[model samples]
Target chain A: MSDLTEGPSGRRRGRPPRTESAGTRDRILSAAREEFSERGYEKTSVRGIAKAAGVDSALVHHYFGTKEQVFAAAIEVAFAPALNASEVIEHGPLDGVGERLTRFVLGVWENPTTRTPLLAIVRSAVNNDTAAAVFRRLIASQLLRRITARLDLPDAELRVELAAAQLVGCAMLRYVIKVEPLASEDVERIIARVAPVVQGHLTGP
Target chain B: MSDLTEGPSGRRRGRPPRTESAGTRDRILSAAREEFSERGYEKTSVRGIAKAAGVDSALVHHYFGTKEQVFAAAIEVAFAPALNASEVIEHGPLDGVGERLTRFVLGVWENPTTRTPLLAIVRSAVNNDTAAAVFRRLIASQLLRRITARLDLPDAELRVELAAAQLVGCAMLRYVIKVEPLASEDVERIIARVAPVVQGHLTGP
Candidate 1:
């Protein structure tokens, strides 16, 4: 752990280095996600993110140019993992696609890490036009279109809408809207009941 | 039509009569609905509804008491028509219940009058807990439970939730979230594509 041992590429380091800088950026992003989720977009400030990340406000500003940019980055971080439904549809048997899709989507919301950013997005999308567009693109447009393209059925697009509606509606009721009975029902029970209905949307009789 | 004809019920017309008060109340309710629809709950006020109705703010309070009361009345007014789905389920064949239910619900949305207040409720429900509760009781509890009870299916309650998810999700996309493709697609196309899915929820394999 000497100065000479620190120079792997024979370049002297003045400060932490490139990898450390990237880590700092990630920390800032994580903090931004938390701040935005906890307080929403308008109420959260760059200073708050920096404070949470244990960095100066200027550093947060430098890492993420603006609040909107931070939001886009946070959304990407949140949704990119759950947006893999296209693959399940592309390779899996058509019959089980609904169950697979239902499990994947509900699983995302059930997890705290992913759900936090999504909650922030859904909450803001209620009143903010830009947020709504961001959400629509992330959900209905980006992820859903991929699944629909792979399906072979009459009015496949509309069928996919119906399928999406079932899941999204359940999510709204359970999470955002918080309707009773459905909201309190166990997750496995819900999946068992709803998965088939979603499948009906996919391969109709 | 003058005072000479007052012998009918011993009722003489003075200002505009009792019927005029009822008409004025309807006007205020209509105005409140419009204001709440255009601007969300927090943004709307009794003054705004009164202005929209072309009546004094005092009259709005006199009729509806408070903004909360106005919202409750507006929600009841909006949902009363669409709440007929239970009766359809009660009297009609169990198999065709899906088509009848889907058609009735979508038809209500197609009409501008019903859709306005519904759109307002859905939009507000996204972030506002009060609005969400009101919507839940109206659509999920008041209407769908009756159909669920008659189904005699296992997990009947969950089935109802699943059915509600499909319709509510589609409605959210079409009128509230305004997702593309599905939002712009014709109503009959939606019901045709979705009714089977709803039926599947009710009577699953």
Candidate 2:
């Protein structure tokens, strides 16, 4: 067999163009995460991130248009796995929806990858109006709406929203503010304790 | 009988001191509230607050020291009147405690005087780490601790903290983010709906 490869124009060529572009994009995103996590959203500039990534500033712009978009991307990466929450909800018995929901949320917060970026987004939101607006939209659209849509009840919207209020509030106290006891408590213990109340909010009359 | 009066301080000096210093302090507090509410903590400078009150900047400093101190004082003014929350737990029928607690909390959030400064604090805390620290301390020491202490249950502390989480989270969604249904619903209806859950968390097994 003869060695052959495809190129931009269908003939054998150098390294694939798509892979190179993807690599550059990935490098920029990786650098953006580090910059954001280290210096926060406001302090980290595009040039600074590009410099750290060893890429031209214009290339950074070419990939992610603005600082906000960069931030949104970073947040998306952090929160991407979180979207799999639908499966958790879907597979669980509906009657114990509250317990399942609480466990899943607690698990996400307890996970290091989700926790760090979540804290970053929350901290930034606390300090910036623009950031808060973005954060709110992200939560509403990505998390709450999906969960609410999956609910199978008349007042599912209200129930889902209330359940959200409960989970978010718990996370705020436990993870963000690090309120004692709750923060240090075992995950199973917390899930066991809080599940019923959460379930009540979701499935109760 | 010569129609003469002795000053309490014994030397009737310079306009009799007017007990107006207290009035001036109140005026400064009012002005600080306006400033904090309108411009937020970081943007509202001491001079701006003093100017709003028609007083010299030095007077504001003399009355409240730093801007943080002014914020503390302003918060105290807004929250002091309402901190008698003990009465809600103590005087109300134990069975109705949840309803009462919810009503009281919602009432405070609905009030313009209380709500405006609170929104400012939330906004500042989201943006400034120092402000967040101060806010955390305020909530932990003044609000959470006090409310928790008033409860005499076995798990009073945990329950109270959870209750605080629920109340704070609801406020964050309804008042600060202005989420629908919650924002537009009748205050009594919300209280009736939410109080039992809070009450159950506090007193249930």
Candidate 3:
């Protein structure tokens, strides 16, 4: 009975199962990022990603319910490290939250691994409304709201939002647009110049 | 024959003629603004826009070739007033460029006519790569380059880029994100506060 149930598949499948191995999931996500970045969201497909990841289509569907969910997961993974930025604010003096935020953001853009995904997101956003909506929701819910919630100031929400705008606009110029000296400057140098402005917005009266 | 070639059914056509009236185009664009704002780029189709505009499907296609071109035209119209921002910069004292720039930008956003499309573009930028690319190209070619080209300072590019970053960052918060009192405060008051900061980036020693 056990042998018959198992068959020769070497798998316990009714509907293929809900969870997948972390390694397999990561592999799919990485491949999906490359595809989405290279082809944009509209051109990318589950079959293409599955082929790139060397996984069965059913397995891909099992892990991620939809293409949008897959893209979301890929972005979440790419941004996972940077998302913990709140911890940096939490650990540091509240007075220097702005500077810390600036440094942290600049640092993320400075690293190629993280910067590429961000650039991909920004580039795709202009023509792809679905991608843009997801990006906006992610930024609003995860980055802006989360950061603002940590601040204890009177206009904390406004200040955090302002800081985010500054950071995102700067990133647009420096990374996505490759605007001159800003694009070429050393990371620490930028942090030195912009940190005070960010700090002021974060904690200034 | 003359009658057949005259009136609404005129047959003297080389390009099939523009079936959409100028008013229809404007009406379609107005509906586009609302659709793009509410449903975003991907979900909003020409059919949807035409239905909203009370026009035929062919008329919509006749006026706007593709969704991308429609967006481009919309943006061009939205930013039409600011195309000659060089005039403002040229007239101002070099030392006060930042203030003028800041004030000019804030004023534009404070106005309802300009603010709606601007918000739509900014909000949609996150999900659409082509839109972001187009937006970046437009800013770089039409706005930033022209602004920076007139400057004689050694690091004029960096200065111009930073000043833009600041102004745009501020606007992103005050308008798109709706951060207050920056969001609700009088435009002139905010300009008075932010202009010097922008000026320092532009013309300050």
**Residue range A1-205, candidate 3, lDDT tens digits:** 1212212245433233234455666677789989988877778999999899887766666667588878777777666767777777778778787778888888888888888777676555544667656666666667666677678777676566566666777887777655566778776766765676677667777
- What value does the lDDT take at residue A187 in candidate 2? 75
Candidate 1's error at B164, in angstroms? Answer: 1.6
Tens-digit lDDT track of model 2 for A109-171? 998877887667666665556655666677677866777777777766666667767777788
DockQ of each: 0.43, 0.30, 0.22
Residue pairs clashing, model 1: none
Q: How close is candidate 1 to the true structure, as a TM-score?
A: 0.73
* TM match of model 2 to true structure: 0.75
Model 2, C-alpha of B156: deviation from truth (Å): 1.1
Candidates sorted by DockQ, descending order? Answer: 1, 2, 3
Error of 2 at A94 (Å): 2.3
Candidate 2, residues B75-110, lDDT tens digits: the string is 666666456555687776777778877788778889
- Model 1 / residue A148 / CA error / Å: 4.7
RMSD of each: 7.9, 7.8, 7.9
Worst 10 residues of 3 chain A by lDDT: A1-10
Q: Which of the two, 2 or 3, has more TM-score?
A: 2
Tens-digit lDDT track of model 1 for B8-98: 3333321224555667777888888878888777688999998898888766666666787778778777778777778877777889878
TM-score of chain A of each: 0.75, 0.82, 0.81
TM-score of chain B of each: 0.75, 0.79, 0.76
